[model samples]
Target chain A: DQQVKQNSPSLSVQEGRISILNCDYTNSMFDYFLWYKKYPAEGPTFLISISSIKDKNEDGRFTVFLNKSAKHLSLHIVPSQPGDSAVYFCAALPRKTGNQFYFGTGTSLTVIP
Target chain B: DAGITQSPRHKVTETGTPVTLRCHQTENHRYMYWYRQDPGHGLRLIHYSYGVKDTDKGEVSDGYSVSRSKTEDFLLTLESATSSQTSVYFCAISESTTGNTIYFGEGSWLTVV
Candidate 1:
């Protein structure tokens, strides 16, 4: 069974707009959440992360919001740029598992210039 | 950027043939992991190592084996390749002090015919 899931397979946004990518996980033990961005023929790169203790974390134009009660998390990119176009994956790490992360299917984002 | 390297960035192998992928890291991180990315599966953990000789299976450990005789190297082997195994594999490394944030290598694209 997939513990993490991205309900949307893809999203398209205009440049300079806000892009929101969402993720849901079934395991309540997950204490850390992260987002990764992957370009074609390249490895996924870390974007942002949020600890369970905090509801939100931000870095530059990117922010991650976690809702433990709803078992959901969302990654928001403000003033989305064309360079942000890529596949986004959300991953969760369970507290008991030592660095064993569960990843969602991924959402392909297209930032149209 | 994390000093992680994955060998045979691309490979095509015949079914039933043995295939091995190598991951080397210079970061000397205590944790290493192997994950496969499929169309709908996103990325699923195959195996992981916490120490030089300490290894453990992940959610999708079947048909896969791993070895970590050195702190800088983690090897993943497919006993017998199958068409269903055609996907991109990723190697990641992390240290405990970094809150278990893993860094990924470029990736290895494997095509099993």
Candidate 2:
């Protein structure tokens, strides 16, 4: 069974708009969450992360919100640019598990110009 | 970006042939991982190593084996190539078992014909 899931396969938004991508996890043991952005030919790079103690973390145009009680998290991009178009993956770190991470299926975001 | 590099950025091998992919890191991180990316499956872990000569299987470890003789290198080997095994492989590194950032290599594209 898939412990983490990105139900939306794809999402599209116009420039200067807000884009929201969601992820859900079934495992309650997960306490740390992260978001990674990947381009066509390159590896994924770290975007932002949030620990269980915090409900939100923001970095420039990117913001990640976590809701532990709901077992969900979302990445929000304000004033989305065309360059932001790519596949976004959210990973979860299970507490006290040697830092082994579980990844979601991914959501392809297309920012239109 | 962490100092992670993957060898054989692209390769094509015949069926039943053995292939090995190498991941080298200069970060001296204690945790290393091997993951494969496919169309539907975002990124699935094949194996991971916590220390030299120590390893553990991930979600999809079938038909694959891994070894870590040194802190800087982790190897993933496909004993016999199969068409279903064609995918993009990635190597990742992390400094600690806590909420450390995971960095991925550019990736190695492998095709089994």
Candidate 3:
């Protein structure tokens, strides 16, 4: 039983366009959501995060939207650059737990210049 | 980018052999976690420790064990390696204030044949 799911295994987008990655979670107890980016042979780095109290959070070129009603969330990057190409992971933190997290299978994003 | 370090970044072992991976942090974070990443499964939690001598099992703690003797060191041991256990392992640490902002180590790749 996958508590968090990222249906799309991979996505490719043009360098000057927008790239959107989606994720879904089956648990309603999740109160915090975060996005992390990973490159080959490196550890995942924190990108952005949103709390359940809010529906959306933005940081520079990255924006994350949370839809609590649908148990869905998305990460959007504008003016995608070649350097932005990497694996993106969606993680959720349920309130009941002591901030433990659940991660999605991850989506590999490739930006074509 | 914290001072998280993982030793034995790459290892290969035969079935039935025991192997151990070590994660050391210079930041002295109060929380530590061990996660394994497989191709289809994002990052599954193996175990976590809230403080020295305090630990708990995560979602996928079947074949793994963890111990945190001091604030800077946490270890994961595979008593009997198996082919199915071949995957990349990651160690993450976070302070109590920024509990959601988990910092990960470079990761250790283990291939059990």
Candidate 4:
């Protein structure tokens, strides 16, 4: 069973626009969430993360928002650049599971230049 | 860079053959993970190790085994290569000090014919 789900398989956005990727999880025990960016033939890289205690976290052009009650999270990339075009994955870590993270199917984001 | 490396970055093996992919890390992180990436599946955990001589299975552990004999080395072995097992594998490392941030290696591509 997939504990995490990314409803959207793909999304396209014009350069310099805001790109929002959404993810939902069924497990309420998940207390930590993260976003990873992956390019073709490469491993997924850490992008941003949010603790259950915080509703939002931002770094530069990237922002992550978490809603614990809804078991949902979204990643927003403002002024999306061509270089940002890649597959984005959202992962969740349960409060008691030691270092075990469940990942969503992923959303392919295309930032058209 | 987190100083993680995967050996045999690309490999091709025949059915029933045994294959092992090695992950070496210099960070000495307490947590090490092996994940497989497939189309529409995103990333699925195969196994993980928390310390030397300690290991645990993940969501999709069938037909796969892992060992951690030393702090720097984690090995993932496929008992019998199957066509369905052909996919890209990634190794990740995380430490408690980092607070849920996991760093991934470049990735290893394996093909079972």
Most accurate candidate by DockQ: 2
Considering only N, C-alpha and C atoms within 3 Å, which residue pairs clash in candidate 2? none
Q: For all the predictions, what are the DockQ values?
A: 0.66, 0.87, 0.65, 0.65
Show where candidate 4 strays beyond 4 Å. none
What is candidate 4's lDDT per residue for A15-73, written digit by digit as tens?
A: 99999999999999888999999999888899999999999999999999998888899
Tell me each candidate's TM-score.
0.97, 0.99, 0.97, 0.98
How good is the docking of model 3, as DockQ? 0.65
Better of 2 and 4 by TM-score: 2
lDDT of 4 by residue, B1-113 (tens): 78999998999999999999999999989999999999899899999998999999998999999999999999999999999999999999998732479899999999999
Location of the lowest summed lDDT over 10 successive residues in candidate 3 chain B: B94-103
Best by TM-score: 2
What are the runs in model 3 whose C-alpha is more than 4 Å off? Answer: B97-99
Q: Among all windows of ten consecutive residues in candidate 4 chain A, which has the lowest summed lDDT?
A: A93-102
Instruction: Please give the TM-score for the first chain of candidate 2.
Output: 0.98
Clashing pairs in 4: none
lDDT of 1 at B39: 89
List model 2 lDDT by residue over A1-113, tens digit each: 78989999999999999999999999999989999999999999999999999999999999999999999999999989999999999999998988689999999999999
Ranking by lDDT: 2, 4, 1, 3
Shift in Å, residue A73, candidate 4:
0.3
For model 4, what is the alpha-carbon lDDT of residue B79?
A: 95
